[model samples]
Structure formats: structure tokens, C-alpha cells
Target: MKLRETLEAQEFEPYIHITRGPGDGGHWARQYAHRFDLVLISGGDGTICEVINGLSGTDKPIAIFPSGTENLFAREMGVLPDCDQLIQTLKWGRRVVMDMGQVNHRKFLLLSGVGFDAHVLLELNKFRTGNITHLTYFWPIWRTLWEYRFPPMTVEADGEIIVENARGLMFVSNISRYAVGLRICEQARYDDGLLDICFYHCTHQFRLVKHAWNTVMRTHCRDSMVTYRQAKKIRVTSTEPIPFETDGDPVGNLPAEFSVIPQAVRVILPP
Candidate 1:
């Protein structure tokens, strides 16, 4: 059955809004947010991130319908945009408060990456024409890994210098799992009031390929070249310039600060 039929059968007054382009997530939510008790967004992580940023100062709870290319956040939350499951969540699910990460004033609910992954996102955004799939990443990743220069960066976690002049990849995670089912930061907790930071201290292409395989196997956290920590605040700077991405949307070049807004957004989950 259709979503409207399902919701109507469940006795709910559901509101539907479709986005026209990038950056419309916030607009749609802001324009119609006051008319509803709960806002259910149907998009991938990037679209959800835009909505989160728009809903930063509001009190209404948000739910996801998972309708984009890489639904990383939905995958992490075990949410699928099926009528049965959505109805179940809307009718019987509990509302749990989840933490959102802030980097230079922007909010992200999933994870953020600096260096290689960010470069891939930067390249991917150039060709994103509202349709993206797994195959769309192949060429971008290949080109970035081979041609992108590794910039040295300095990282401070909780006021201590953990990395200085290092050429590696950094992942600040609010969720344990990443894109394509990779658990890069297994220690991440959405309610723990901290961000999980993982550093892959390898710049060579072959080593990164090995690291990718290890991440797929969920063993990257234990590798000797990897450093993992939990912190409420982190500051990152680079000698040149470092690209960064939050929830798969390329944000900007870094000299960035990352911190968590503890228990800010309430999310409805399957009971």
C-alpha cells in the first residue's frame, strides 16, 4: 500500500513535502515545521544533515525516511523507509534523544571525515546531478587516491597535541558505522556525550588500500598505525589546506573545530 494509505489506516495525519534541489531541506522544514508535531524527512544523510542544521534551534522531533543514495545515518540507526516499519515507529516507537556533532557551527548527526574521504566528496559533488549510486564513487575515489596531495595536519583532542605534522586521514564519528557498512570507529556512541576520533596514520596509496580492507573486516581499530580516542572537543589545523565533509556533504577547507551538542535532537526508533 502507499504511505498515505498506511498512515491513514494507522490514523495519522501525515504531511508530505518533496525537495527541489540541494539546500531545500532546511527551507521546507522551516516553512512548514510549525504546523506539525513531528517532522519526518525522506532523504539521504546529506539531505538529513541540511534539515538538522535548519532545525537546530527548534524543539520538534525529527524522523528519517531514508530516500537518498547513501543513507549512512539511516543504516546506522537501523531505519528503513518502509510503510510498515514507519507506521510502527510513528505509532509505537519511543523518542530517544541523540547527540549532534558541531564543526565550525554546522551540525552533523552521523560522522565527519578530513583528508581523503573529504577529497572524494569534494570531487563527487562536482558531478552530483541529484542522482548518485555506488558506481558514482569509483572514479572519484580512484582519482583522489592517486592524484590528491597528502597535507600535513595538527590535531588537538581535549587540549593535548595528539598529532603534529601528520599526513593521514581523520574520522570524527557520532555513529559507529560509516558508508558501505564500514565500521571505522566502533566505539562511537550517539548518547555518550563524546565524539569518537580515529586517525589512520598512513599516506601511501597501497597502505590506504590495506587500511580499507582492514576497515571492511572491522579490524582497523586495532591496527598499529591507527589511533582512536574519545573527546568532547577537537581542534584540527593544517600546514596547507585540508578538505572535510560532514555526513557526505563537502563543507569546506579546514582549520576546523569539532564538538558535540549533547542530547540535542530527539529521534524516533523502532521498539
Candidate 2:
């Protein structure tokens, strides 16, 4: 509401949109983006993901309000929560063109997970009621941690076999930072026309926990069980369809092929 007042005070008549359910943000954005100069989004990572999908392949730049839990992309772009900062960003912000990742046909601007983390979201949605916070994930994480099986999978990067029949977690990211500031893809550059994929080879629950700790310490790359690579295209296949989370939503199961779209979107960034 304060954001609305601020825009109104500045003599801008912005159309207000409130999403009613899943994919509404993207639906509205894709349908009405042609009429707008700048698309401003208010919500969390999931909402931002939807908006990005709607505006994919267009020149319409976006500014975020960063109201959601773990607003990872907003933090990566240096967007803040204050209305004053938002006003400054609007008036004198840096304009950046960023790369986006595509899984199948859907687009993502942050990171995608293809293993246990994605499994957590799949379980969370089974009982998700409404808006979620960091705490909302605790139960789901705990449950998925116990139930998840380290499925065997094969990964190909630019048509080269990087991982063959590996059992662990796979992360593909456009940015370095993830939830809780972990640099899962530490060398990722949003404009570099490549996606950074990290595979943590684990066979048991204890190994999974160790991998998580090493990742948080930013030392996972040096671990023998970890594989990190940057590629223009990445493909992962499993004996069974495994669920993958894009941005923060558990969209569907995978046999996913991920490709990077260079300079695919224009974004307003804090200076």
C-alpha cells in the first residue's frame, strides 16, 4: 500500500494487480505487459518467477518490491525493501540485461534444483495453505530429508557427459547467491550466456547433510564428491521422472533440458 501511495504521489497512475491464485501473476503479466512501460512486481520469489515467465522474451523491464520470503533475485540485484530506495531506483537505477534459464519451455531467473530440495517443495505444496515464510519450509524439509532417495541420474552439458549415473543433488543457477546467501554457483554471471550447474554426489542421509554444510561454507567445490560446470545447455535424465524446482516452485518432474537465454530480460537494479 505504501508503494502504491508513493507511485501516486509521484504523479504515476499505476494499475494495481492482486494475484488470486497460482500462475495469476504470469497470466496477467503476459496478457497486459504490452501496455506497460515498466512492470513492477510485489511479492516473493514465487511471484517474481511467475512474472518473469509471463514477460519472457520481451524488452519490458521489471522492478521488484521484494516482499516475499527469500527474495533471492532481489538481493542479487541489490533491490531493497524501503519505499525510498525503490523511488531512487526508479529515478536513477542501473539498467541491466540478464540471462535467464529455461527448463523445458518455462523460464527462471534465479536457481533451479533437481533433487532433495525440489522434493521438499513438492511435499510442502501438498499441504501449503497460503503465503509462506522461512519457517514454513522447516517441516517440509525435515520430512523430505527422511523420505528422499538419492536417485541415480546422468547429466550432460553441451552434449558432453559431465555426470553419469550419479546420486546426489543437482542445482542450476543464473546467479551465485541462493537462500541464506549460499553461493551455490559461485562463478555464475547473469550476463555470461551460461548456466552454472553443481552436482553433489551423495549416497546416504549423512552425506547429504555434509554436502549441505560444505555448500554453506562455500567449500563444496573442493570436495571430491562435488562437480561444478558452466554450460550453455545442460541435460539431466533419470530412470524415473524426478521433480525439479524452478526459482522456488515445484513445477513438475524432470528429464529436464536446461538452456541459458543470454540477455533475455531487462531489469532495474539499485545503483
Best model number under lDDT: 2
- Prediction RMSDs, each to the true structure: 1.4, 1.3
Q: Alpha carbon lDDT of residue 9, candidate 1?
A: 85
What's the count of clashing pairs in each model shown?
0, 1
Weakest ten-residue segment in model 1 by summed lDDT: 1-10
Whole-model alpha-carbon lDDT for candidate 1? 0.87
lDDT of each: 0.87, 0.89
lDDT tens per residue, model 1, 1-271: 3766778887888777777887888887777787899988887787888887777778888878898877878887889878788988887887889899999988898889999999998888788775888999998999998987678888899998888888889999999988877889899989999999999888789889899999998898889888899999999999787999988878899899999999988889876
TM-score of each: 0.96, 0.96
Q: Count clashing pairs, candidate 1.
A: 0
User: For residue 80, what is the lDDT in candidate 1?
Assistant: 85
Tens-digit per-residue lDDT, 1-271, candidate 2: 7878999998778999999988899999989988988999998888988888899867899988898878888888888888888888888889999999999988898989998889998888898997887788899999988888889899999999999998988899999988877888888989999999999998889998898899888899999999999999999999987889988878788699999989988889776
